[model samples]
Target chain A: MSLDKHAMAELIANDIPRGAYVNLGIGQPTLVADHLPADSGVVLHTENGMLNMGPAATGDQIDPDLMNAGKIPVTELPGSSYFHHADSFAMMRGGHLDVCVLGAFQVSAAGDLANWHTGEPEAIPAVGGAMDLAIGAKSVFVMMTLFAKDGSAKLVEKCSYPLTGVGCVDRVYTDHATFLITPDGVVVRETFGISFDELAARVPVKLLAPAR
Target chain B: MSATICDSAAEAVAGIEDGSTILVGGFGMAGMPVELVDALIEQGAKDLTVVSNNAGNGDTGLAALLAKGRVRKMVCSFPRQSDSWVFDGLYRAGKIELDLVPQGNLAERMRAAGAGIGAFFCPTGAGTSLAEGKEVREIDGRTYVLEYPIRGDVALIGAHVSDRMGNLVYRKTARNFGPVMATAAKLVIAQVSEVVDTGRLDPEAIVTPSIYVDRVVAV
Candidate 1:
């Protein structure tokens, strides 16, 4: 059975090392914040100038002015601090973040990432902090479906969409399976429901078995 | 001393001529200077350039200005929110120009302008299409793209409270770009909910000092 979004989030959460300084990209990646273990010691950073941000706020706890880069209301942890936007970007671009989880439209076998724009003329260009996070984070994890709704594979030989970062993706967590992009190739770390042979048949690229 | 409180929004935005660039502070509508934007609309200055995080929302504020065709160009990060129809329509028709900077780059460029830095190298967009035509350098085995500073002729900002001395405090997330914009502009006008006496505010709570603010209008 393919994992649902919540299940996929839980899977991603399990891999997060303790005491990580993480930045969650806008959509699906943001869900990872809620599933993190309470004692994970993860410090969440929002590009819009907040650090140590807690989970999403609900009801009266929602403060209109306290929001994530995605414009969703969020709570601040006890040691949370706010800084100028430039300083915040400095933290991101200066290799200070331990890991950043991003939502991807496409990831290449070589670990290239393309998440920002589809390059459609009519589409509004909204590149929030994807580029910085993609290149700056020590480790980059992509959270997305393995295939598009149209049944097209998102893991391709090369990215058709404009790239967010070149060869920056380290791991990909999909509903069907988890894959790691290594210097050798895209390796199947784990699969949810499908047999290894079936998954290999479905995937467009060659998949290596997990290293013993 | 005393703050330079303007009697009206029009007076606060006075001298904003055509073709001028204005830095507008806010992230959506939260800390937006609505009254100041309204005053700019009423002033009807044409061929203007606006710098902000988003293009605009819905049919009001910055959107209203765009709808009126007062804006010649917009330099922003995210220009395509669901509510940004005004910008979308105009951009599609080739009537308005867009400079889509990365969110962090936009902030840092403004900060660089304020801090008197000419240009700086950043690793954010170094290898992407956004780095096209820009200078790229290798520093200590990492690639960085050169980005220049962005400054404005005037800035419209919002604040929760201001003392007559022009010391300002923002309300929560609404303070997004106000402090940085204030420093990057030649003239800074703030729209505030209330203005207290000069010494009424605790100095520690002030985010933007009077030095950067030129005028204040209580909305």
Candidate 2:
């Protein structure tokens, strides 16, 4: 079975344990929350002040008052608490979180993440809380496509985009493969398990995915 | 009574007192009221409760106050997102208070206060712990939680331009909370990089009219 972006995202969400304090990075990374098993006690933390978040609302139940950093409306799960902005971050920086799920524009072989800033001066330079979440969470899981817009491998030997946080990524779940970064190198434990030379043969340009 | 003209940033923010609640404008650092925050820090004010979207990157915007040991409490949607130096520093020192509200909720609360709305029912905190002690009401068979209005004693705003009459215009993210907080405070003080003449400011560009403004200071 060939897995698509949504399928890979769902597979990643299934791995999150119960009672996880997680942060969903903006963009496609947000779709993971929808795939989370209903039985798991995962608490979604938005850097914009929310914990124990649920899926997006359907109809007029949508409260314009409750939204994430993207300003999109969301629903709250059981046992949710609203708090002071600093306290929400205290949870992140204090390392009280279990996992952080983020979207990446690129992931280097060393597991560097570059998702926030595009390095273009004309682009908005705002990094927001991606840096804090990447480094602060116990585990950082990046969800991204395996390739770039121009068909170049986004899983690169080194990220061309400006880094949001250095060497903080734990595992990368891409549309094409799920790769784990370890002390040795990139290990393709599941989905795509080609040897280093074989993996390099699968694409053109420099190989950034963890070298096994 | 002699009218004292305060020209410097420190002199302007000296009017604020300890334990006072202040509103700061800007989504990020794009249009933060830097001059007023600087003045507040220079004045060495203490035990302040600040309301803003996010603390500016450490050493700027609201983070400056968080760094100076001046702020006692912060009411915001995303304080830690900036990873500001002061957030960790002050929080660990136990010198600051924090209250995290949903982003849209905080904005609405400020707007509610400004619009003279006492309290409203929202479905934001239904099944979550966010609804712990609040009154839960059912309207049309659906449950809604109550949210209180947010107001401040003073609103410290940054503006692109302001007329002598106090009409204000904000640029980019600086427009985030400026207008809402303007009408939600007992006193409104604006720091404008440029000051202009009345009636010259485009009507559509006026985020806050002079009626809600109490004082204007040129940065």
Candidate 3:
């Protein structure tokens, strides 16, 4: 069956192994938290300062003390514990995370990542913790739009935007297609309904399809 | 008629002046003191120094101040890179000075000030460039780093609800900076969505007591 971005995200989340620690990047990637399997035991790690956090609360039934790095109020599972901020980043940069799902402005076929800044002289230069997660996670997954608003492919041979992490991204999930980066080239995992070559043509680099 | 607080945004922010240093309570996007921020934006106060964990995104939070060229300095740890028009403009124009504090130290510094603890030391930034020029003290054959107190002239905070007597409760992430900075500021103004009767809130739920708050406004 053909899967759109939402469906693809849900499918990928369903496959996450039980008890795996995962970090959800901002934007569309943040939406995956809504689809975690009820019967599973996956734990969500928020960069702000939450672990084993539940989904957002509906009303006044909120705890102000529990929030993500973004200051968004979040729920705490029974086992959740709060610690020093550096300890949280230590877990991230020390290679303790199992997987990380991040949103990307651009990803290279060679597994490079560039999602932090746009290099606009008039833009804020806050890198936050992207560089830490991209290099620290055991495996990296990128979620983004298949193409930019200007009709250029965000999945390219090399990123033009400043790089966040070099040759680190392993899986690519997008609105129109999903692929895996390989030593040979960009290998098609599942294009869902879109044509592989059609999306590849938009990319600035050479494309090589995986052997079926 | 019983006494009432300012009835308009203008009156709400009339006390704020140019070149004032303010501490705001919020993690990043959560529990931001929206009403007071809106009032400040509307009041158009300029050349302000803001201390917070994150610079609110463009058109929101502290970012709104940057958008208006009202901010003269920023003391924060995180500011998103995706959108940058407001913050970048202020930085590039040399109108803003940035002080990047480690998250824990920032929170602790405010807490220490609020608690009237003049200064404290920790090993958080020790052996790193973050420790540059800071006093280093050793005790019991161990090294500890010294960090100074950072208090604000005023603290602008958001609460889920507050009582008539000024006890405060914050929702989830909104609780991050509010309670700590409440006591640290000379004047604390809480902007809440609802105002309740005294003793209406659970004793355990009160994050900031009436003593720390000078004023409360229903958003």
Best DockQ goes to which candidate? Answer: 1
Q: Which candidate number has the best TM-score?
A: 1
After TM-score superposition, the amount by which residue B19's alpha carbon in candidate 2 deviates from its true location, in angstroms, is 1.0
lDDT by residue (A1-212, candidate 2, tens digit) is: 43676887798789998878888877777888888888877888876556787777779757644566555677777776544344455577568888888888888777787876577644423445666576668899988777778878877787888776667788988765678877777766455444556656754434444445
lDDT of 1: 0.89
* Ranking according to TM-score, highest score first: 1, 3, 2
Spell out the clash pairs found in candidate 1. A65-B173
What is the C-alpha lDDT profile of model 2 across B65-110, one tens digit per residue?
A: 7877777788875665535667756665667776766555676678
| lDDT for each residue of candidate 3 in A18-96, tens digit (9 for 90 to 100) | 8899988766777777777887788888765567878875587465567665445667788875433344556775678
For B111-144, candidate 1 gives per-residue lDDT tens digits of 9999999999988887789999999999998788
Segments in model 2 whose C-alpha atoms lie over 4 Å from true places? A1-212, B1-6
Give residue A117's lDDT in candidate 1 (0 to 100): 96
RMSD of 3: 8.4
Which portion of correct inter-chain contacts appears in model 1?
0.65
Please tell me which model should have the higher DockQ, number 1 or number 3.
Answer: 1
lDDT of 2 at A76: 76
